[model samples]
Target: MLFLVLLGFPVFILCYMLAAPVFGYLGDRYNRKIILGAGIFFWSGVTLSSSFISELYYWIFFLSRGLVGIGTASYSTIAPTIIADLFEEGKRTTMLSVFYIFIPVGSGLGYVLAAGMAGLTGDWHWAFRVSYSLSPMGLSHSLWSFVWSSLGLTAMAFVTGALGMWVPLFLYRAQLAQGTVSPCLQETCNSSNSLIFGGITVGTGMLGVIAGAEAARRLRKINNKADPLICATSMFISALCLYVALMVILIAFGELFLSVNWAVVTDILLYVVTPRRQSTAIALQILVSHLLGDAGSPYLIGITKNDCSPQWSFRSMQYSFVVCAFVGVFGGAFFLLTSLYIEEDRKEAEQTSPSSLNTSSSSLKEAIFRV
Candidate 1:
């Protein structure tokens, strides 16, 4: 079961990484609503099918996950581009923040829902069925909300991928290192730890989304090019918080700080890209971010943990997290650099907008009539 759980994430992420570019291209060329709807339907159908899988055929479950990844890739790449087309400036940032808040909120709810359903029914399959039933409602909502955000995302991904995969183990090791035995020796203790983590994640994530959006909106009032500055500053602060969390004992604070980074980056990406190229920009962001981020971090951390001497033991995971903190610094630097060019890009894109061109033509026609 452990092996399956570990292996499934990479397989799904790999399929998502591969399919994103193709779907992104299609999104630019086709009716985005149709593509988005089809993706939601396909993923939901596959998710429903998983509830029926027999215990004898476990491989089918993995396959279904991969297929679901492909389906989600279509929606993930295109939906944000559609949102970008629908809004401009601070309004776009606000909408994207609202869109992304659901990510952590849904994740927390999933864990709670699954646990509740399993506890009530004494069967896990019912949990899957309940979730599968809700897919259509999400699909019914207009497709909404990624992107330059990719650099920060890649950095953020590495941090999250490594931390998420290893944090429980690190906590267990910390318990041992302190030479204090507690109730954490039981499996239930691990579940409790996970629930605590999820609560913090959801709470901080929603706060960060709202706070970041409002901050960006205020910054934009001061300067139109302020989005990238918000991203850069948030990322740098997040990196500093991660470093402190690594050195100290306050992991929850690090998680809280990390939550704000995504909102800022998403605002920056949409603010800079032209509507005509938003899909392709988002696709590239997804591809680059995952390729460098989650796709390899789990394996990388696992190998790092294994390679360390026996004396270091589980402390090896801590060392791996240190690497992630430094990577956060690198991500911050990328966003800082992006701030320098983002204004120029936004200006160039605006100059090429159809409305601007039409206005220029109208002026020319008036001058000719006067002549």
Candidate 2:
């Protein structure tokens, strides 16, 4: 258990980070659809490969897990960019919201599927095998003493990867030219002035709720239209309400906290990324969330377990999920508010500086607003 905990999460994060850039680059340089298709194909293949190991060969398992991370990361990065490419920003969040509704359901089904497969075969190994085999068809296959999903996914990967190579060149040319149209010309978030201002602002804002409130108040004073305070306040209130709802549901319905969080977070991400990147955005969101969120959580739990009683350590770690749930609720509300503020700010600026709108890239702007 310790070995699995230690090895699993870091590899998940490392591979996630490594692959995200590749996907991002691919989305930028080529057609988003092809990148997304390839990502799906490769991710499924690696996921199936993971089930093939008979022994706890840590390195081999690590490598296979890494491959899974790579495929997933690539998909996330590319998918979001694709959505951004196709959709207008105003409707992106609603579209993403619809897309994200699947995560919780999918995760829950995964657990059931794993358990059912294990029961049918009377061997844990068969669970992974069944997972791999069933994925290509998106179906639950017949019972078997031994089955391997890795082979099926690998086959799919080969086919998808080959087909992806043929995606149109015109799309790349169009995106490249689009980058120069107007929004891309706006100052990058990474510029020197932005770095200093953004860093300090974000840091101070995150330090305490009061700081964020104060900042919001100042913005509202200046613009009379900015509602940062209301956004922050709404988030706090909504989080409290959700906490009560969660407690009720957990007690009454016996719902798992992690499963619920997975559902909530996924929906939030889809809502935010959809208008900007559609299905491709899902890949990028997964990469970032896994690379930083779950990766860090597991590592922290591992460290705690090492120093303390394992039972207490695990319990404490589980408690963190409750905190995370509230954070997610709050974070979502805050982002909505921030987006409103940004839109208002942009509209005001656009009235005076119409040319600035054309100089910016929608992709870049969407990323900023979403973040």
Candidate 3:
């Protein structure tokens, strides 16, 4: 059943990855705000309607997830381009940090709200429905930005996907193994793990985003290579943090480092890819990242755990989690590779941007290097 639930995420990602190119092409040629707005509506409606589904037709829920992906496609493909157009240099990076911070923040909040409401009401469906009551709402790249950054992000996604799906369960199992908690025999087990996990996610995510943006802004003054380097360093440290599974403090630090990549990576995309092609670049980045990244992470972790299981499921899961650490190292390496090309890509992007008219390539390169 956990495996089945995990499958929907990859399915949604696959749909999201595949649909992004279409939206990318459209966004480049059309009005992006309109497309973004339309997508939000489509996404919201589908999500809201899915809450009403009955267990007899649970499969339809998966289909709705796929539809949700299409809606996500438009926003993912185009929204960053809007930001890129609006801001420049350090300002752009800061704005983007604010933008991408919402990814984990939303996830963290969703987990808290859904779990709290469900626990209080004793109906899981109400968890999904609470969003309607609460109201509110609301990649890719040039080759260097797309290729290296996406490679890095893919690993981040992989680790995030596995951890996101399994951490609560893993925590529960750990306590059980220690004889600190009893095994849950109820159909629905009430536990504080989700609440604690959600709080950690929100806190770590918020702090990480703020710290990363400030670090990048300061570092960029001296180094043309700061963004990718920051990403590389964060990925490496995150790998270390993730390897120490039993320490929740280490896990929090791991999440902090992981969150650092969100904005930095997007900022990398904006500077390396031209605005005209940004939508497509963003789309392609999403495609490659999700295709290779979170799309299969949770499912792969699940199967690996299942295969390794003997008497203790927790031990097997711990073994499966080791994979995430290695992947994080590879992600860091990809960013190092990115540093090789970022300076050249930034100049090229500047030359081709809409505002580059009448500017010489030499002048553009000079301005980029000065930054």
**Top TM-score prediction, candidate number:** 3
Error of 2 at 84 (Å): 3.9
Candidates 2 and 3, the one with greater lDDT: 3
Write one digit per residue (lDDT tens) for candidate 2, span 146-220. 011111112212211111111111122222334532334322211222233223223322232233333333554
| Candidate 2 off by > 4 Å | 1-6, 87-95, 134-291, 301-322, 325-340, 344-371
Instruction: Work out the TM-score per prediction.
Output: 0.88, 0.52, 0.90
- Point out the higher-scoring one by lDDT: 1 or 2: 1
Candidate 1 lDDT by residue in tens digits, 1-371: 34656877887888898889889888878899999999999999888898888656879978988998899898888878777778876577788888888776766666566656756786666766988988873010111112345677788778777766666556655555566545346344445555665676678779877877888788778786576666667677877887777665457666666666666776566545556666777777788888899888877877654444433755666676777778878877776767667667666666666667789999999999999
lDDT (CA) per prediction: 0.71, 0.41, 0.79
Model 1's alpha-carbon lDDT is 0.71
Give the TM-score comparing model 1 with the true structure, all chains together: 0.88
Candidates sorted by lDDT, best first: 3, 1, 2
